[model samples]
Structures are given as C-alpha cells and as structure tokens.
Target chain A: MKNNHPVDEEPPIEKPPFFNSWKGMYWLVLGNLAFMIALFYIITKIYE
Target chain B: MRPLDWIVLLGTIGFIVIYGIWKTRGSQDIEGYLKGDNSMKWWTIGLSIMATQASAITFLSTPGQAYEDGMRFVQFYFGLPIAMVIISVTVIPIFYKLNVYTAYEFLENRFDLKTRSLAALLFLVQRGLAAGITIYAPAIILSTMLGWSLTITNLVIGVVVIIYTMSGGSKAVSVTQKQQMAVMMGGMIIAGIMVVSYLPDNVGFGDAVAVAGKLGKMNVVDFNWDWKTSWDDRYNFWSGITGGLFLALSYFGTDQSQVARYLGGKSIGESRLGLLFNGLLKIPMQFMILFIGVMVFVFYQFNEPPVFFNEGTKSKLYATEHATELRTLEANYSSIFEEKKQAMQSLVSALKTEDEAAIAIAETKVENLNAAGKEVREEVKALITKAVPNAETKDTDYVFISFVMKYLPAGLVGLLLAVIFAAAMSSVASEMNALASTTVVDIYKRSINPNGSPMHYVNASKVLTIAWGIIAILFATFASMLDNLIQAVNIIGSIFYGTILGIFLVAFYFKRIKGNAVFFAAILAEVVVLYCFYFTEIAFLWFNVIGCVAVIVFGFILQTLIGKNEKELVKV
Candidate 1:
C-alpha cells in the first residue's frame, strides 16, 4: 500500500494552456456556466 | 435495415474496433493496462470522458423526453458544467499527487483499509449493474423496434466492447472513444439537419423552431421553485445545481469509470484540461440532442405520427380482442392529427405574420388538438395493457428511433444506428475497463496478491474485463423492461451515488473525521438515503444531496463521541 495520499503534495506546477493560472481556468468554467444559464433563460423567454 | 444501412453500420463499428486494437496492442504491465501508462493527451481524455458518459440511452431517450415534455429536460444538466469545474480543480490534483490507480486507493492512505474496501465495494455494486443497463437499455429498444432477438442484440454490443476492452484495457477504451464521439456527434448533427429539412418545403427552419416554441417545446431553463411542490420536481435550476453537482462529484471524483478516463492523462494539466473540455462541451451537446427531439416533435406535427410509437407492442395489441378498439382509437388519432396539422400550418403562418393575437388564437387551437391527440394516445396505452398484460406501455423511448427507422434515408438510418451503437460501446468499454482496474488494483493486486508480478496483475485484469463484459451481457439478456429506460438507470445510480459521494467528500475535504467514523457514517447514510427512496416522495436527484449531507453530519457526531471516549480511556 503506497501510502502517500492525503499528502496534500502540490503537483508539479505548470501553466495551463491559454491561462496564466489555474484560477483563470476555473473561472472560465464557472463563467461559462453563468453565461449559458443566462442565454437559456433568454431562449425560454423568446420561445415561450 | 437496408443493405446500405447495414454496410455503413458494420463498416463503421468494424473500423473502430480494429483501430482500438491496433493502437493499444501491447500493454504488458498493469499500469499500461489500467492507466495507459499515463500517455493520453487532454483532447483524447476529454472526448473519452464525454463518450463514457453519453451512453446509448442519451441518444435514445433524450429526444423522446423532449418530444413529450418539451426542452425543459435540458435544465437537468445545468449543474454538470459546474460539477466538471469542481472535479478539475480539487479532485484531479489530489489524484495526481497520490499517483493512485483507482479513486479508492486514496481512501486507503487517508482512511483505513475497510473504508477503502467499503468504497470499492460500493462502486463495484453500482457500476457493475450500471454497465449491464448500459448495454441492455439500448439492446432492448433495438430488439423491439427491429424485430431482433434481445439476447443477440445484447451480445452484439457486449462482445464488441469486450473484444477491444480486453485487448488494450483502459487505453483501448480511450483510443476508440475518439472515433465513437465523432460518429455520435456527426450522426446526430446530420439527423438534426435532416429532421429540420424534412419539414414541408414551405416550413423554413425559423418557422419550425417558432412553431415548436409556440407549442411550448423550447423550455430550456427553469429557475423558479416552490418549497412545497418543488421538492419532488425532478428537473429545475435549483435541483440541477445542488443535486446534480453532488452526483457529478461522486461520479467523476469517486466512480472508477470516469476517474480512469483522466487518470490516463499524461500529467496534471492534461487531466484537468480533459475535464474542463467536458465541462465546456457537455451542455451544448445535450442541448443539441434535446433540440433535435424538439425538431422531431415539430416534424411529427406536419407529418402524421403513429398513434403509438412502439409498433411491436401495438402489433401485439392488434392481435388481441381489443384490436377493434385499437383501430377505433387510431381512427380518432388520425382525424385529430389531420386537424392539428392544419392548425399547425396556420400557427406557422400566424408566426410569420408577427400578429400576437392571431398567434395566440392559432396556439390555442393547436394545444386543444394536441390535448385531444394525447388523450387518444393514452387510450391506446391503456388498451395495450388490457391486451398484452406483460408488455411495456411507455413509448417515449421509441420516439426518436421510430422516426429514424421510418423516415430517414437508408444510409443515414445506418449512421444514426451507428451513433447508438458507438455510444453504447464507448460507454460499455469504459465501464468494463474501469471495473477490471478496480477489481485488480483495489481488490486483487492490493489485497488478494500484493506481491504478484506486474504482468500477473495485467493478466488478471484482462480476465476480469472479459468476465465483467460477460456478466453484463448475461444481465442485459435477462433484464426485464423498465418503465422509462433513462430514469431507471438514473434511479439505480441515485440509490448508491449519495453515500459514495459522501465518503469521497470526507476524504477530500473533511480531515477531522477519521476513517472509521466516516465508514460507519457512510453505511448509516446509505440506510437513510434508501429510506428516502422507498418511504418518501423525494425526487431522485435529491438523494445525492441527502446521502452526502447525512454522511458528513453523522461522521462529525460519531467522531466527536469517539474522541470523548478515547480521552476517558487514556485518563484511566
């Protein structure tokens, strides 16, 4: 049992593509969610 | 099936299976077998992740859901993108840190072996059954529609998956998924275009969509909730975000089928990127599927749809004493559809006129006819039950496939069928690979044979992959029809998902709760969730929330009491 977990060891840090930090990537996902919800809401109104 | 349709279907599946075998030919060690020796790039992992989740049921039932209920079903996935982000940020990094083979392995280091084993057992119980349903759900549908044997259809899906999955294991599942995803999306896009084009020459794309919207089929987002009534509402913004988030976390973070996808990634960045890709693309993909269903619903408005979609069930009804009654209902349905079709044409014209009053008038007429048609269909379902007591009565699952088989061109029919099979194989292959790796890494290699050579574990995994595939095929072969295919699978998932999610949540975030505490808590939480499922009127999605919260709360209380008792013992 290679017991090295719950280790909280930081992964070898590298810049994610098209983002300076991982934070940017996370925000992009969350932001996209917000935008999609808004866009869907608009579609619902326009259609219904 | 036409000869050309058969050619397209067979040629497509044959090439994918051969490609998967060729690409991942010589996986000699357990790491390469189970994790692809961490050689997968982000894009492959991303497509593989998407393919693994989009089983045949997604293609089959989703459009039907839209046809009957409208596009409000798309709201169910509102939480999934958020879920993808959560996994990418938190779950992926820890997995990379540990270099673990399965998600359960991290539990062993953080908790005790029992906790790890308990989680693994939970996964095996849930995913193993799910793998069977993955094949069975589609096979049963195809069998009834095409007059094929259910057993043969199940083997057709099961054997192909088992072949490639056993050949290269995890790498094979990923390698072939890229092709499967292409086929699934391409076939669906073509189907969507064909459906829209199949509308009468006068009905432009805009008119078709406008007509669908007017008919209340464009419902994509629902944000409102009532405290009393909304608790059991299956699809809404609130439930999707909260319950869907928990379910996705458990699935992607804890479930081996999904964990294996990203675990094969080349590095932390690759894994994270893979998940993010799914997050970005998954919702739109679902929207497209549901929208196609909406377009099909629109298509059926102009062209006369069958009184009953399940022709097989209807044929059985046709033989019974109720045949005359069924014929009468079909006549009524036809009479109502002829009027409804004209009303729909008027509605399209009204929409073109941009006259709100005229549009409202046409909409009411169409709604009335639609209601009349629905009542006739209900009468047909009731008649089916009276005639054939054992046959399945729900026809929504057949809505999309019936359209494809009856209306789409020959080669396109084959391509869409390939979409369904590719989706099934892609998902089944992933599950078999995941099941094998979990059985080997978590149970066999770790506990059963800790000192065995890498090659021995690799061989064991191959055997287990074939074994799981066979078991899935057997289960699919014998499984009876459920009420709704997609919901049946989701219900099974909801039953076990909450407790598994809770355990992983504790392991990942709640450091204070010891392994024993959370282990027992997970068991107790499972009991509570099952109680909710059987005893309460709670919606299935809420089970994810209920089980997760129960584990944390129960673990905390138990941990506190254990800490008190230990202190007293130390003082003595």
Candidate 2:
C-alpha cells in the first residue's frame, strides 16, 4: 500500500529506457502496418 | 495408437514439469512470489502474454471456426494491435510510475479502496470462470477424441498445471510458456502443412483454397455496415475500436494476470516491446489458425465426414430406435456432399481453364448442395439429442479435433494432443498466477495481514492458487451448452470489462469524481449492460461500450449531486 500522498506531488518515475522514445513508437507503427498489409494481401489474393 | 505418440506426450510433459520446477525453485518472499524479482526479459514476457491469450480454445476450436465459417473470425482481433498501442501510451506509464504489483494496486492509489476492491472482485469472478473454460476446453476435446472420461481428463489438466504454477509463480509461467509456444506453433504449422500434403496429390494448395473459397469458407472480411446483422457484427469496425479498446485497456492495464507478466520485464522498454511484439504477431497468428479451419473444410469436402461431428452423441443415436433414420439421413447427405464435391472440382477446373460459364453453374450447385447438407445435418442432430437427451448437441467444436484423429498420422496425433494440453496449461497457468496475485496483493496483503512475513504471504499465494484451480474445475464441469466456449469466455469478460474499465477510466481521467460516485456508476453501468445484452440486438462486444458509457455518464450525475456537499477533495 502506497502512502496516501497528495495528487500534486509527482510520483517517483521508474524511467525505464525508451519510456517514450521515437524508435519504440516507430517500430510499433511500422510493425502494425506491415502486418495489416500482409493480411490484406493474403485475403485479396485468396479472394481474387 | 503407436508407441511414438505416447513417447511424445510423456517427453513433452516431463520436460515442461522439470524445467518449471528448476526455474521456479519455490519462493519464500512475497516479492519473489508475486513479482518474480523483476527479472524476466522482454522475450519471456512476450511469450507469456501470447500463451495466456492463446489457450486450448485457440488451438482446438479456432481451426473448427475457420473450417466451419471462414477466415473472417480473424477480424475479431483486428482492433488488438491498435489497442496495444493505446495501452502502451496511456496505461503503461501510469502503472509503471505507481510501481504497483497488481493493476488493482494502481486503482487504490488513483481512486479509493472500495473502487479497487470492486474492480478486483469483478476480475476474480470473470477470470475464475474463464480459467475453467480454458481447462475444460481441451479436456472435452481429448476426452471425445481419445475416449477418456471427462472427469479424469479435467483432473489431469488441472493437477499438472497447478503443480508447476505453485512451484514457480510468474517465472515458471513465463518459462513454460516460452517452450509451450514453440511447440504449439510448430505443431500447428506442421499440421497445416500436413493437411495440404495429405490432400489428394492432384489437389494442390491452390485447389484446396479455391474449394474453401467456393464454399464461402474463406470469407475473411464483411464490408457491410449492418448493426442488426449478427453476421457482420461486433467483429467489425465500431466494436473493434470502442468496445475492444476498452476491454483490452482494462485487461492489460488493470488485470493482474497481464500486469504481473510485464512487471517481470527487465526494464519498461522491454515491457513495451513485449506488448508491441504481441500487437504485431497476434492477428497473423489468429489468422493462420482460422485459415487452417478453412483448409480442414476443404479436406472434408473430398471425404465423407459424419453428418454430426461429435461421436459421443452419434453413438447414443446409433444405439437408439432412431438409428435407421439417422443412418439414412447420413447416407443421403454423404451422396449429396459427393455431388457437391464434384461440382467444386469442376469449379476449380473451370477457374484454372478460365471458363466463367462452368464456374457459374458449379457455384450454384455447390451452394444448393451446402444448403441441403445443413438440413440433413440438423435432422441427424435432432435425432442425437432425442437419443441422448442431455448430450452436447452443438458439433462445431468437434470438427477440427475429429479431422485430426481420423486423418493425422499416429506420432503427429500425439504431438497435436500435446499441443492441446500445452495450450490449456499455458492459459490456465496464467489465470492461476493472476488469481493468486490478485488475492494476495489486493485482498490478503491489504486487508488480512498488511504486516505479514514474506513466508506467510508466499504460503497464502500458493493456497489461493490451489483454491482458484478447484473453483475453475467446478465451473468447467457445469459450463452450459455455449455456442463456442471461446466466445462464451469473452462474453463473460465483456459483461464485466466495460464497468471495470469505467472505474479505471474515472481513476485516470475523471479526477473530480469520488470513488463513491464511480462505484454507484459501475453498478448501474453493469445493470444497463446486462439489460442491453438481454433486450437489444446489440452484439456482446457492444456491451463493453454500453457499460463504459453508462459508468461515465451516470458517474458524473452522481458526482455532481454529491460532490457539492462534500467538496471534491484533491486527495490523489
């Protein structure tokens, strides 16, 4: 149980690497886009 | 029925059990017991999450879904990757900053004790039920295929998972998951390839796909925007975006089973990467599994499958006075199916030869034959029910398993059975872990003994794991004749996820609302969601939407009514 402190004081941040890095965000978007494309291509090919 | 299959099953279990015990080493400390000392790497977290989500239903029924329906069930997960990105951005930072063990811990910090307890209570109920389905799913398939007693099968699945999970906690769950995933995927892909290879040499992959497509078993997407049509329902754009987002957010963000997996990550980046990896792989993995079902459908077109797939019911029907009638219906369906198969073959040949006229004729014949087959199957199904009054009449769950047992080679049959067990164990183990963590961290440590020794907490965690295991088995024994155990589990989650998500949303975004207001809103939201499920034509996924919106809308009304007197205390 955390000590019930006021909301104004910022909680201690663990700040693990790449918490909000551009590379992480890039890979996330890129990975999803690639997967979507692959799925679409397969479905379209099968239908065609 | 070969020695090879026995060797494979035994060897796989032996390795997983010994490896789990070796890695778990048993914990005496709460930190080690509940959180795994924050030592798991990104890959382990990734695999653990995948295993938890996969379950026996994913393996056993997914192919059947694809085989019976088509690849469109994959759309159910189209919203997952987007939801993962949303969680990584919004929920991850908040929970990590709080340094919480269970997701509910963050609820207490952001909201109040009552809100946390309510959310935890909801999770305990839903996951407790889902865990049983996960165990019961494979047990049903194995019992039906191998002719084992359902009770014995359920006990075997529960006991193996419990021993490993009790020994290792999160680490054991992760390690066994990594291995299980490798085997499960390898087994599934091999099974898919073998399906193609085992097809008549003249029927190549192209022909198999063509047959499945011609039969409407390859329909992967429905562009129609019909809210009323259950065909193009919740597994679509709107529910996928709104309701799916809410469910995924609450699950990964607040559910301890998932939260504990990431907390074991060596670093937050690793955790994020692990989640992101899941986002990338999950849809395709689901798609592939569903695609296998379509192939299985194609395989059955060439072969004369039973009018009803479940042998258990079929046998009872065979022994009854309706035996002649059922066999006659089956024989008629078989002949009609053969005619349709000829039509399908002609259609495939026409496509290759570019004969659109032949294609048209063949397509119409095939559709009519399929419609006719459904009528015959339904009659046989009715006879089965009349013969064995209380038997499971729905046979979609049996299609894929039936194919595997009748067609696959002996050694591969054993490996596939192992895959079923692995899938069941993976999901159940995670459920047991999550259930244990929620009980210990949210309820036990907070209320029962805040200052309890590490050894005492460790013991408590183990006991809770065993207790939840028994509860799940009991639920499995009585699981109603659900359409699909897979969908049933998700429906149960949908009923609760939105309200739980609403509470967490209030904690995260609605700062002015007190726990009291949100609590009332949550109960009202649940009632409203339940009403929608009962009274409206809305898909079950939309229940999440109804529930979330209800809480947010009703919460503000209650907050305004009450907060004026109390004065919104900025107690965060």
Candidate 3:
C-alpha cells in the first residue's frame, strides 16, 4: 500500500549516540525514571 | 550588591547579548530570522529548549518551593520523559516535513485556517502575558531585595532581550541560551556547594541530608491513591504521571516557544535527539535545583533565617501600626529558631551515634520545632498583610534569593544575580521570538498581506518582535497582582494548553473529524475548562487532562452530527 503520510516515507531513524536504537534510548529514559522513583522511595522510607 | 557583584552581573549579561547579536548577524531572510535557517545542532537545540523553559522564576522560586514543600515537586516531571518520547516520535517529524514557520501553520494544513488562527491566538494570549511575567517576576523580587529601582530593572531586562531578539530573531534566542544556561547552572552549583560548606563543622553533607530527610524535606514521591483527596492535591506520583504527561505534551508539542527551538534544528534527527536529551536530563536538573533548596533548608537549621524572607515587606511592617506586634513576632521567631537549632543538633548527634530509637525521637523533636517555626512565620505573614494589604505576602519566591544575599561570598552574589537575569532573558527572548514569528507568518502575512515581498515580511517580523516586547514590558509592569510567580505561569498555560493539544490530537489521529467540528469543540472545551478552574476544587494539573478530553469528546459528537447532516442533504 502507498503511504499517504509524507513524514512516514523517509522518517529520521538515526540512532542516538550511545543507544543502538530509538527504542533503546526510550527504554533508557524510562529506566532512569524508574530508578529515580525507587531511590526517592527509599529516601522517604529511610526518613519516615 | 557590591561593586564586584555589579561588574560580574553586568559583564556576563553584556557578553551574552553581544555574542547573540554577533553570531546571528546578517539574518536578512525571513527563514533565517524565524527558524535560524534550520542550522542548529542537537546540543544547541537541547540547551535552548531547557533555557526557554527554565525562566528566572524556575531559578528563584523552585528552590524555595523545595525548601518549603520538600522534594516531592520533582515527581511533577515524571511524565516529561514520556512526553518527550511521544513528541519525538509523532510531532517532530511532521513539523520538519511541513517546513512550517509556526506550529499553528501545520494546524491550517491539517484542519483549516480558522483552527490555526484560534490555536495561534491562544498561544499568543498565554505566552504574551507569560513573557512579561518572566521579566516582571525576577525584576520585582530582585529590585525589592537589592534596593534597585524596579522600573530600571524591568527595562534593563526587557530592552536587552528585545535588542538581540529583534536583531537576530530565533537564532539569537538559541545562541544566547547556551551561555545563559551555563551561567544559570554553574552559579546554582556553586551556591549549592556553598550551602553545604556553610553547614556546622560537626555536620557533613550526609548528616545534613539526614536532617532534611528527618524534617520531611526529602520527600520526592507520594503514591497515595485516595481519589477523594487526590484531585485537590497538586503534586503526587499519579497526578504527575497523568496530569503532568498531558501538560508536557501540550507545552512541548504545541507551544511555539518550545516548538520553534527544535524547528530550528538541522534535521528531524537533531530535533528528536534534543528533545530526548531534555527528557532524560530535565528531571535530574530539577532534582538538583530542589536538592539545593533542601540543603538551604538544612543550612537555615544551623543558622538564623530572617523572620520574613522579603525584606521590603518586613520593613513595611516595621513602620506601620503593627510595628510592636512585628517586633514581638520577630522575637518569637528568634526563640523558635534557637530551639530548632538545638533540636537539629540533637538529631544530628543521634544520626552520628547510629541509635535508631534516639534518631526517631530526635526527628520528632525537630519536626515539632519546625512546625512551631512555621506558626511564627504565619504570624509574621499576617502582620505583613495587615500593614501592607496590597503587598505580595508569599515569601517562598524570596527564600532562595534571600539566602544568596546573606550567605554567599561577594563575587558569587553577582554571579548568582547574573544567573537570575540570564534565565529571565533566555525565556523572554524565546517568547518574544516565537510571538513575533506567529504574528508575522501565521496571522499577518497569511491573513492581511499575502502578496507582500520576502523582505517586507521579514521587516514585519522585526516590527512585531518589538511590538510584542513592548506589550510584555507593559504587562510586567503590572504583574505584581499575581502571587506565587511560578504557579501563576503554569496555571495560565494550563487554562489554554489542553484545548490546543486537543485540536492537534484530533488533527493527528481522527481523520474523520473535520475542521468545523474540531474548531467549535475547542472553543466549547476551553469554556468548560475555565468553568472548572473558577468553580471547582479540581487541581490545576488535572485541568490539562480535562480540557484535552473534553475537546476530543465534543469533537466526536459534533463530527457525528455534521456527518449525519451531510447524509440527509445527499438524500434530499
């Protein structure tokens, strides 16, 4: 099927510097957030 | 400020403005003026994005927010990374492919001209006022704290930003932001280190963190899931994820000030990398700023803090009929501070001894003392209100600056002041630049004089930049009426962002919905959001979610009705 969306034809798929793919980069970001939340939770528990 | 501080502040600002003008010289064409000729690399785009969002108020008020409310505010950005990932995948490529000047220009292609104009008008209204507030917020606080004339401070900030922004346009905003971000973060790091160093000799950084943690300043997340109370609560894990996600999507996806940053990028790849960079680093950057505030909180436990953070308001109370009462409150505050110091010392000692039971008891004592300190502070606030009813009584905005003036060494004071001014200029410059591009491209050239020459439109952009700069200055002059500068900016954005985001979402995902239905749905959704804001207890963050949802729901209904009418007309 022909792609109607012009942007989807040759999308920019250059990987970020460290990550192998964009998906990997996104996972790294989400993982970082999860780590931060866990660390904050631990801080809260230790203090409380 | 001392002579050294003045030189540091003025020299740093002078260098940035000149460099911006110099680097972006010869931007004769409209494309170069409006979009930096699509030449910016990812790092420049990233810092510009960060700089445009982190206004002086972020520097001035965020730490104070952390100092007073604890680190839970960091949770507010939990959804930002998610928003970044979504925008990178969806929004950036589309904008890059269209080669549009403003985000609104894409709306015209996707929907219709009126839809584009409506979105542009909404952005102008919010961002225009926000531009002024960016200048006014720091000007008011700095003038009062430093004994400078408020008018001079506002003009210095407004006119400097206007000159470079008008001269070089979008590239100027992007270029100067790199320098501005350096000064901002560097000064903050120095201030953070000084805060820890100023702690009592017996206490270390770990001890201070323990002290802050014990006193509830280390609270970075709250997963409490009570819907009954959650809607009214501003920041929590759930609200941050859901509400914050919506807000970030709207702001980064649709807001031209931000969109313009990456639209100036070299390619879709550069823009996407820039946004992903922001997503990854923004939370840590905010956490660091907030942690600096927590350190300041710990520092105040060892030393004496002012009864009222705003010296101007405190002085006004000193001269009024409530002078004696103010004096008594000051004494009471002093007594509470002494007791709090002793309690903190005991808490520190308990931590040193590693005695869990004693640590718990000491923590309670410190918490009680902190509560008592707050009560005395509230009494002081009441006295200030009684003395100067029209004055801004909220002191959290003043907390970080007050600490800087009192404790930081001489040259660092000037450096930090420069940080505030740089932050203010970086944000205001981006705003004025974005406002000008939208006015000239989306509204003026497109609507009024479609036949104007390229140079004519370019000059029109410059004229509009100056015009919007003036409007922002005038607005800043009258911005003192609002309390809590940072929240005021966000609330104004919230009131408008959801509807804008909804319009874009429908345009992107709902091919069946035509321009007419989505346009009216946007207007109706805005009214409903405003009603919720004025008449309900729904937290400001949720307004983003509500406004977006309302628009989508209304769009589907209106489109179905319109579709049925078209079918009936065919039968007739």
Candidate 4:
C-alpha cells in the first residue's frame, strides 16, 4: 500500500490482471465494446 | 414526503458529507489538497471519473429520454472506451512524467506559457458556467416536482459540495464519489425492481420487455446511416463512435474535472486501469438506467400514465381561462387510455399464442391507440402554452420522477431523492475541486504569486473552491430563468473542447508543430467553430471534430509559412 515512487519519476507499471501485457487489456475493452454492439444489434432486430 | 422518507434522505446525504470531511481530514498540503497526494487506487479513480461525468441531469433526464426516444442514447458513449485506450497509451504517461497538477501544466511543458494559459483560460470560462448548471439543472426539476423552492434546492446541493470540497479538497471528492456511485446505482437498481414489480401480475418480466419491444421502445441500436441525415443525428452508431470519441477524448483527456480524477491515482498503472474500468462499465451502466426507462414505458401501458408527465405544469392549466378545454382534453385522454389498455392486452395475448397474423392485428390496434394518446398529449401541451404562457410544456424530464412519487413506497422515494442529490453533489464537488486547482496551479501560482508556500497554496485552493462554488450557485439561481440553459452550457463546452483537444493532440503527436503555431491554430480553430455555431447549420457536436482537425491542418500550414523564422527563433 505504501507508494515509494514520487510523481516525477516513472511509477512502476504493473501487469494488468488476466493479461500479460496492456495490449490484451486494451483489446478486452474494445472487444467488449464490439460484443455489446453486436448484442444490441441483435436486440434491436428481435424487438423491432 | 413521509417522515421515514425524510429520515432516509437526510441520513444518506448527511453520512456522505460527514464521511467525506472526516475521511479526508488529514489533507493539508498543496499536493494532498489538489491531487489527493497521489494516494488513490484504481477503483477510487474509476468511480470518481464515472461519478464526475454522471451529473444530476443524467439521473433526472436519462430515463425520461428513454421513455420518449428509446435507448439509442447509449450509443453516445461508444467512443469512450476507445478514448480510454488512446489516453492511457499516450496522455497519462506525459502528464505523469511532467508531474503536473492541472492539465494545462503539461501544455507549458510541451509548448509555451501562453499556450498553457490559453487552454486554462478557455477551460475556466466554459467549466465555470457548466459548474453552475450542474447544480441548477437538477435543482429546477427536483424543486418543481417536490414543490420546494428552487433556490433552496440549489443551495443544498451547492453548499454541501462546497463544505466537503473546501475542507478536504481532491481527496474528499474522490473518497466521497465511491459512496455516491453506490447510492446512484443502488437507488436506480431498486427503482428498476420496484417498477417491474408494479407491472400487472399477468405480465411477466419477459412479457413486459416484449411489449416494450413491440411498441419500439427497445431500440438499443441503429446502424443505418447516410452522409446527409447522419451528420445531424447525434446518437447513431457512426456519430457515436467518431463524434462521441472526440467528445470523450476532450472531456476525459483535457477537461480538468476528469483529469483531476485520474491524476490523483497513485501510479501510471492505476490510472490506466481506472480509465479502462470505466470504458468497460460505463455503457452497461447507461444501458441499465435506460432499461429502467423502457420498463417504465411498459408499465405505463397496463396502467394509466398521466396525460402530461409534468403535473406541476399541468396544474397551472386549471386556473387559466382554457381550464374547460383542458378538462375536455383530459377526458379524451382517459378514453384513449381505456382503448389502448384493451389493445395492449390483445397484443400480449397474441404474442403468447405465436400467431403472426393475430400479432400483427393486435400490434396495429395498439399502435393506433398509442398514436391517438400521443395526439391528446400534444394538444394538452399546446393548451398549456396558450393557457399558462410561460410553462414548460415538455414533460419527458418529469416521467421518471413522477412515477417515483406516485408509485414507490415512502422509504424508496427518499432513497431515489438521495440518488439525485448524490449525483449532483458528486459532480459539483469534482468541478469545484478542478476549478480551484486550475485557477491556483495554472493561473495564480504561475502568474501572480509563484513564491507562496505549499500551505499558502492549499489555503488559496480551499478559498477558490468556495468562490467557485458560490459562483456556480449564483449562476444556477439566475440561469433557471433562461430557456434551454443545459443546451447553452453544452454548446459552450463543445465550442471550447475541440480546440483544447486539438492543442493537446498537437502537443502529444504533432511534435513538429511548435508552440506558437498550434496556439494560433487553436484560436483560429475556435473562431471557425464559433462561425459554424452562429452561421452554419452544422450540428454542434461536429464542432469538436472540425476544431480538432482545423488546428492540426492550420498548425501545419502556419508552421510551413513561418518555418524559417520559427526555426531561427528556436536556434536562438
């Protein structure tokens, strides 16, 4: 919980959970967006 | 309000205010006061960011919007996740590297003092006005519905936010936001459950949703687009992805209110994770709120909805000379509801039977009756205009609150009211904190008194927080008399955001363009957007795109024209 790094220095970048790199995290977000859009599209067709 | 409702409302808001002050009581230095001493974790940053953006009008108007227009508004947030990715990859590191308090501090690092001051001033101008509306927009609606004085409602929101923000500054804002977000989401979820429970026993949850869909209120997506029509459409998929992206980028990227949220994070990873958390959850949160609206719409089908949702406005019609006419219209509305109620039953039965032809016939009957009901409502609005003269005729904003007052139990009514108050306080607190930090860091310290001690600056920040809070309260008080004031604040934000984003984009990516070129380009770009606002029929949302692109384009051209002098100057 203790933060040793000051604001001026590069704070240590930690690995994101479930992903080795930040790229996977970015894709997770984008992929979630795409999936939601598709799901919404399906809902539109079903209800409309 | 019942005594139980009053107790719940007061207890909820009082707990948040007292907890905010007490939890952050240790904050005394400038770093802690302005940026929470870089002590916030990912969840704190994420919730603070979401809470800051989710204003009182969001809680107050969004469901009403869904009741009238369906769920297409959720698309407006489509670009936010992408923007989060972009800012995380670029802007966060630069800001962290420079150790800036306000976002404009980075502009000075990247370009010149003039450019920094310019961005900061534009922010102050627009956000200062918007902070007032943040309090006023909800105050007007709450006061109207509750029959309380508008000034009292505004003061309650403004003064509570100021008390905590002034006492503990950024830490208080972030700490309290976690609770505020909980209240907002919890209150809405409970409201959603109550609405569903209020549906007729004959109608199951699936049946209610089907009814909503058949009536076209389940429209959650629209991919159809053409250049001519789509440019003006604000909430379609394409505009949402592109235009919404630019708007979010400007908002979360450059807007001090938002920047302050993540800038309080303990590390780069925490800030990045915080934004990504929002990107992933913000849409679903909006969808949940809009879905509650859809359910409210369906509930109205089996039950009688008020002919006009704003009972306050409708009541004004009774004292006027057109009172007789209004009574007749109400009669017509009641009869139409009877017919529509029967038609809706048939539609539900037909859907259950899975008979296409029967379904079509029932759907048509329901649609026709719905149209008739709509006509009666429109006539009532017209009558209200003629009869009350100055009454606001649009009732979409009143739909959800009216339902809560009319249907929800006493304790839940207080909880819902707490939800709105929590939302307003959360947003106002962030704006007050951000406004104070920007004034102190970007303007006061840099220009007026650079030699002040850290404690002196913290005191100055607390004073400025109170000052901005008072200004916002005053603005909200007077702004209620103006028409379309929310739209006015939004226009001001859009006009400035694009140019600010452009300057930041130039700073981050267009490194070849120096400070003077981009600064002038930003001014010129803002003028072009202003011209579009005043002269062209272009939608205001596009001003963000135009202003952003114009800055980069003009920055290039200006740099090319003055390359020799700039290069020489740089060498010197």
Q: Candidates' lDDT values, in order? A: 0.91, 0.80, 0.90, 0.90
Which candidate tops DockQ? 4
lDDT of 2: 0.80
1 versus 2: better DockQ goes to: 1
State the lDDT at B64 in candidate 3.
96
lDDT of 2 by residue, B1-572 (tens): 57999898878877987888786673347777777777777778888888888988998888887777777777677667776776777777777788888888887887788888888999998899889888888888788778898888989999888998888788788889999999899999988998887777678898777777777776766544764565327565456655666777767776777888888776676687778778878887997888888888877777777888888778878888888998799889989988987877787788788687988888888889988999998888777767778787778888888887888898888888888889899899999999998989899899878998788888888999999988888877776567787788788888888888888888878898888899899999999988887777778877776788889999999999887666555443
Writing each residue's lDDT as its tens digit, candidate 4 over B167-225 gives: 98999999999999999999999999999999988888989888999998888888998
Worst 10 residues of 4 chain B by lDDT: B480-489
Off by over 4 Å in 4: A1-13, B481-490, B564-572
- Which residue ranges in model 2 land beyond 4 Å of their true spot? A1-27, A30-48, B227-232, B567-572
lDDT of 1 by residue, B487-534 (tens): 888888888889999998999889999988999999999999999989
TM-score of the candidate numbered 3? Answer: 0.97
- Runs off by more than 4 Å, candidate 3: A1-13
Per-prediction TM-score, please? 0.97, 0.93, 0.97, 0.96
Across A15-40, the per-residue lDDT of candidate 2 in tens digits comes to: 33444664566466557745674665
Rank by TM-score (best first): 1, 3, 4, 2
List chain A TM-scores, every candidate, in order.
0.68, 0.52, 0.67, 0.72
For model 3, how does the per-residue alpha-carbon lDDT over B150-216 read when each residue is reduced to its tens digit? 8888998999999999998899999999999999999999999999999999999999888888888
Pick out the ten consecutive residues of candidate 3 chain B with the lowest summed lDDT.
B21-30
